[model samples]
Target: MKTYTYRHPEAIEHTGEVPVMDEQGQVILYSQRVYENYLKRTFDKMFDFRYFLKYEVLDSQREMLFTVKKISRRGKLWFEAVEVASKKKYIISYENWRIGLPTLFITDRKLKIQLEKEFEDWSNFLLDEVEIAKWKAEFSEELGEFHMTLQIHENSPIQQPEFFVGICQATLFVGA
Candidate 1:
């Protein structure tokens, strides 16, 4: 399995470029958050309603890899991600509750994935009851930031790993 870490300032609002690094501390991808207008940007900063913003993931060469946009946010958070080259679409739904951890659902045209935070600060992506990926979150008081780690099993069946990373980025943007 390979481990990747993404560390960012612990703030409700994020903008500009954020880096995702490998276990070796090498940046593998950059995620950028963009708002449609100044009003939406200010609203996002003041509240948790991030449906007004969009996210873009770029490679080392600053080439756009994929884009994530909010599709709905009434009771649950829904997002749509499109790969730049293939134009493949992924639908991600997050079910939030007043108690307990939220549940994340990711699906493409055929495959469906269910991820639930069964423990505090830890979540696992399960496909047919088999664990394929693990996600862990830690807060650093010294740096006043949050570090998110994702570990993908070597034999994982998932094809596009970057799409999951993009979903993670969207979750971070919405405080999910």
Candidate 2:
């Protein structure tokens, strides 16, 4: 098994680059938040919170790996994961209002994403019933850092860093 980490950018500004690290604490991938429009950015500032955010993940070679976007559906937020090269979407997650938990929908694969603790909390989740990738959020901290032990499935097609990033952000930073 391998470990990876994601450190949120400095909060001096509302937006910055997030670094994805390997077990050795070396940067392997990076993510950046994107807004759909100036109006959305304005709303985020005016409300003093973020509602919708799109993250683009890039590898060390500067190759785009995936793009993940968080959107509002009904009364909850949902995530969309898209691969860069093939433009393929694999999985999407939406909240279960009855349990107040998020459930994943495997769009194009016969895989599953289950919460690590099974609805105890929203902070941690599993990739495929196993704890391959887990997120630990630190939103109230000084740097707003969120840590994770990410191990992308070697055989799964949904091995995008942005996918987990979106999941982590949705778990920690929900304002809508």
lDDT of 2 by residue, 1-176 (tens): 45577766434224566778877888888777767788888787775555666667778776778777766767665667777788777556554634544455535465676644232223444555555555554444555544444556554445555666655544444323
Q: What TM-score fits each model?
A: 0.84, 0.71
- After the best TM-score superposition of candidate 1, give how far the Cα of residue 113 lies from its true spot, in angstroms: 0.7
Ten consecutive residues with minimal summed lDDT in candidate 1?
Answer: 167-176
Residue-level lDDT tens digits of model 1 in 30-101: 877777789888776665755575788888777889888876545665789899999888887777734556
Estimate the lDDT of model 2.
0.59
Q: Could you tell me which residue pairs clash in candidate 1?
A: none
Local accuracy by lDDT, each model: 0.75, 0.59
Candidate 2 deviant stretches above 4 angstroms: 9-13, 73-76, 97-106, 116-128, 138-144, 151-162
Candidate 1: stretches off by over 4 Å: 46-49, 73-76, 96-99, 159-161, 173-176
**The best candidate in terms of lDDT:** 1
